[model samples]
Target: MTSDREQGTGGDLVATLIRTAGRRADPPADAYRAVLAAAEDTWQRKVGRRRHWRVGVGIAAAFVLLTAGAALLRVVVLPMMAPAEIARVDRVGGGVATRPAGAGAWVPLVAARRPLHAGTRLRTGPDGRVDLRLEGGVSLRLAVMTEVELHAPDLIRLQRGAVYADTGSAGPGGIVVVTPAGIARDLGTQFELRYAGDVLRLRVREGRVSLQRDAGELVAAAGEQLTIDTAGGVTRGNIARDDPDWAWAETIAPVPDFNDQSVAVLLEWVARETGRPVHYADAAAEQRAASVILHGRVGPLAPLEALGVLLSTTDLTYEILPDGTIEVRYQ
Candidate 1:
């Protein structure tokens, strides 16, 4: 019962509301694309952050490992690699060599002035002899069938044999010789220490030495000899410094390099070797010796024998006094 114009207007209004509602329910294609792009961007950012975190962790781990390795090298590896040199092998006669620490086989050591490190074990054949020059001008002579260990520059262990130590003028920093029976400590002295089966002997040539055992201790001065028995009993007696028993030591004594050295220097060496003071016939004789320069080699000769050869070049002769003094005079 309504007019046609009113009915047409009402239909148009209804259609317009329906179109607006459809547009609100379904978004445009551009808006859907923008939402997908934002989600993809957020996912890519999260992946990048995780990758950066892994790289940072790896770098930190490597640094820690490097630091730990360096510390280990400094503390343990370097020290084991570098053992200190305490002595030098000056001479090796017969079949003298060294048995390295923790090694069973013996290695033949040639006389090439090889450096000897601490804890090196030395062994000699039946006819062997070896001479060692320790730090601080000390000399150690080992006789045949002897075995010794270098504990330090100022210390040695006499396992089984004889050793002559001359700690020349280097004030003793506790030079010790460890024997099976006892220990002999030098007081800036020259001495011979022998260790055999269940016995140890010490003979002081110049200066004092202290021998210690579980029983007690005794000091032996120059020209004194002490023996320590297996039972730790100590016995001491007088012995000449130049006794014939010491002749073997003289035979193996180290010959000084007298190149371009003064005669006075040579005389001083002879005095030390022979354990005697040199007496010049007069002040002129001493002055002449100071002015003269010696040239030649006294190779492999005993001290007295070498002295005779040396004086034969000049018009000088020597006589050994009863008091162990050498009187040098013009022929």
Candidate 2:
């Protein structure tokens, strides 16, 4: 009987232990709540991280668009703004304008574009002193009162002036002075041209200049001078000598006639004198001239003096050169 009682006690103890083990294997209610809370916190943190990353990317994209738009606006809108003040010079007596800080006085042989930029000014004196300061350190001094139109980045029109151009460090086509006779292209050097009566004088100081005309072209070198007449004559000389004709005819050729035939004939004649071919790019330029006759051999006083004498004889406009090659054209 005693043995049976012991077995029953053992069985009951084993059953109680099994039930306690099963309850321990399963989590408590409070433990389940704690695990759920941790899961929720972890999910919230992941969502917040994703949202922050998305916001950062959005901001970066927005910044890029803003920058690009600003750049585009600058390029599209800036050119339409009003022009800034480039230069302002006081007009001196006799239509001369002086730069506040420059080497010489400047005069416009022709009506010039106003509000010139820095380094360009007009200077003149009634006693045969006129000049234009082209950009690139070029100063063109005239022996006669003259006028010129200044067009920047490479164009100048000589209305009426005897000019000595000294260019500084400018490239080819950097500056051009257009006269009634033709066009002078500068190549970072010094040169001079005078239109007096039917004569034009050209002198080269440091570099070469291309004097282009419908009838001829002349490439002047440093230290060389030439002259020409409206009657198709030419003369070449040195610059050191006193230019007597320039003094007398400084005020002579006040106007340039673009329609004169004598100028073209003179240019062709000058080409003959220079031993170089004068080719006309425009075929009509050769045929569109009226008859204007000139007399005298091509020499120092040949055509310049003759032009002054025959100024009223024919309706011819003259372009003179220092090498004694003159071109007369119809005005």
Candidate 3:
């Protein structure tokens, strides 16, 4: 048998060993819980960072798109809404006045080179004459006691009186002249249209014109004249291109720009303005005309007067024949 003291001591040692073994066999549950919690926190933080980055990128992209769209609207949409320019009041002579679209007050147009827009009504006094430089290389001359309305760049309304039009060589667009009795469409021509007390007259100097009436449509070619009465009866006749009746139009003709232009070109312009054909005396005169350059201003003279001034500088002389031919000869 063993003593009591030894037995107690052995029992104590056995108990200590058992406790140490239990501690080693199982880890603390709190430590495992803390590690799992830390992992979840780290994952949540990473996801939040990614989401914030995406939201920031999206906002920036939206802002950029909105800015670009606004810029595009400004550049593309505004111009189309602006009104088109038709013709300008190139020259105002005598007593010229205008009544704005709907207004009754007649504003005296003392200024030259004023711009005329659609719906503007123009009236000239008995002594008044106005010249208009239309768009597309077209020109118009309004005679005395005339009333006209600019409907658009390519359309005009002649209430009363006469107007002359010249569409240059480029053939930009057909100009429509609306009269009380009929409508005249220019076919790349120089022509005169007159409207008075139930009578309409059309004289084509060059090219052709188409006249439309309620009764029928009539085509008038160069050197042709047509008269339409209030009864819609048509009377056609032949008229000389350089008829003396066209002299009033020449009085307000625009002076040709002669800077570094050839004599031949100037002579051709004179011929057109005077409603005459240019005739060179011989081959040498024609060659000389083609070769010689003209310089200087013609001042504010009529076409014939300006022609006289221009030819004085060269060794050439010209005469207007009885049949309206401008014969150019060597001095």
- The number of the candidate with the highest lDDT is 3
Give candidate 1 misplaced runs (Cα > 4 Å). 1-78
lDDT-superior candidate, 1 or 2: 1
- Give the least accurate 10-residue stretch of model 2, judged by summed lDDT: 249-258
lDDT of each: 0.78, 0.50, 0.80
Please write out the lDDT profile of model 3 over residues 46-83, one tens digit for every residue: 58655765676678977655655654454346435544
How would you encode candidate 2's per-residue C-alpha lDDT over 270-316 as one tens digit per residue? 33223223443343444543244444433232234434445445554
Where does model 3 exceed 4 Å of error? Answer: 1-83, 170-173
Model 3, position 319, has a per-residue lDDT of: 90
The TM-score between candidate 1 and the true structure equals 0.73
The per-prediction CA RMSD against the true structure, in angstroms, equals 30.3, 33.3, 32.5
TM-score of 3: 0.73
lDDT of 1 at 52: 60
Q: On residues 187-231, what C-alpha lDDT tens digit does candidate 1 reach at each position?
A: 888899998876889999999998766566788999998887766
lDDT over C-alpha atoms for residue 261 of model 3: 90
